[model samples]
Target: MQTLRSRQASIAPLGIVLATGALLTGCGLAEDIADSLDTSNSKLHHVDTGAEGKESGLLADWVPDDAEDVHVLQRTTGSERLLTFEYSGGMPSECLEIDTVGSPTQEELAAAYETDARTRDFEVTQWSTEPTMQAEWWSAGHESRTTHLCGRWWVSETEGVFHAFAAELNG
Candidate 1:
């Protein structure tokens, strides 16, 4: 057998400690915060945009129905999490992760939302439990189109943005 040329790259005890500490240093009950970031360098915004919100004209074959107080707006041009919130029963009751476009980082999409003044302090994360596949642009000379669920929530000194967004999406 050949001699080992390099050391294994396993997480060291000290490295683990630092990682854990960094992960734990956030707002809320210290849950899985990664689920809220659309990307590492982006955040979510929550405000009353009168527009339909998230242009969803690219979906191939999809039919979404309105949930409790929120209406699903799948942005075919990008991810599906970009939907409309029609709160008839006051604030929503759960968070949601909609599908969007395949390419580009979620952080890019999140940066688009930073323009909103209603959403000043917070971040966005994408979460999904369903199985997904990598897809690509057929005519554009790509391989596959990856389908994933995403969410956007604003974090702040006070729990206002994410809480309401979760409520809307769940319903």
Candidate 2:
């Protein structure tokens, strides 16, 4: 099974450029990312990170404690370390192409970072209901960060492969 982290390590740079380009054109970075996250025959796997399960890497520390229906989609590029967690009681009828299992709710997302606000490098810099509910963070090194989407999370890291995961998985 291919790992999402490894894939992200390869495409981090391109994602940054595209994200910046999209931002400049008022198209939005997340939309571009969503377009790139192809759902064709994509497979999602559930992980048990609880005790006795050796959870490693970004997902090990970033997934929220209350997150449910946690699933991961492995991609071929470094910017697509798709880790989706559903907190709502039931699944939504419709979801973005990037969503793995279902979708995410704003209220559930709000509770995700209510307790902890620190990731490996960046910190939660924005989280509000203005202009559509969204969340963003910034990194001290390489400017790596993440942006919360409708029912999932997207990471964009701009650093060496060894440190590329600093902002790759933020549940």
Candidate 3:
């Protein structure tokens, strides 16, 4: 009985310590980087606009471009890491593409295509969020105020993957 009690007490403290560490570090929500310029020696950059800005960034700067209302974040899964951009604008049914560099697979590209196809019907209205950006949209009569059409594009070289996740959400 004493051995069992000792084991339980030791395990309980260990579990609590691990949980505290995880919460303190925010386990997995992407790194909290900062706004940056397109320089040779740089990490990540935000365009104040999210996914749309990512597409536009490809058209102009190697990073983010003219993104006025967008937020970008970086997420990781195991050994993989991807930059996620969430965007909202004044227009609807806007479809844009982003040029990928480094290494990625065709399946990754297909995921992005699938995401776009699914979101075609939703009329994007408002997109707001920072640090970790999220896209939001609404319908005509607000039947479904928030639509899954609003999503973030996750891309990264670590995983050699690029995908758009139209998160399941409703308003």
Candidate 4:
């Protein structure tokens, strides 16, 4: 009769063969697993500069046909997506502004705006989001004044310098 050790040794080779066969015939299982587990970092500014304002879905068309200096940022994960747009010279006010933050939270976006304001030596007034759904703030220093706006579905930040351009256009 075969001893227990002998029987176990005999099955070990069979296990290796079966595992190897599965891997060989599994249509790149390793690659598929790696891709599914991927959680790589994404930078908003790394997207194509030209393609920024030209994305084809959701908030893409809301920008004016004549808007200038248009910039866009988008992030997608499975069924969730976030989109942001910035442009200048729109109706009523030709303000240099960001259009929206389509994410669920506004912390990162607010921080970015504050950083920009600080860099420009503009004092950012407290942001307010009450009575109306919009959250808005401004920066004013020297010859520069700017406004930033955001809401649950939309947010816009604009440089007041363009108000003159808007008045010129409307006048």
What is each predicted model's overall lDDT from 0 to 1?
0.29, 0.37, 0.33, 0.34
List model 1 lDDT by residue over 55-168, tens digit each. 333211111222122233322223323223333332233322224423325564355334333222434333221112222211221111322212233111112111111101
* Candidate with maximal TM-score: 3
Count the clashes in each prediction.
28, 6, 6, 4
Task: Give lDDT: candidate 2, residue 130.
Answer: 19
Superior candidate under TM-score, 1 versus 2: 2
lDDT of 3 by residue, 80-156 (tens): 11233332322223333333332223443343334554333543322111123222321122212112121233222
Candidate 2 residue runs with Cα over 4 Å from true position? 1-43, 48-54, 58-60, 88-171
Order of the predicted models by lDDT, top scorer first: 2, 4, 3, 1
* TM-scores of the candidates in the order shown: 0.19, 0.25, 0.28, 0.25
- Which 10 consecutive residues of model 3 have the lowest summed lDDT? 137-146
> How much does candidate 1 score in TM-score?
0.19
Candidate 2 per-residue lDDT, tens place, 93-147, comes to 2222222222224444444434333321333333321111111221232212333
In model 3, pairs of residues that clash are 48-69, 48-70, 49-69, 49-70, 50-70, 50-86
Backbone clash pairs for candidate 2 read: 7-77, 7-78, 8-77, 8-78, 9-78, 104-151
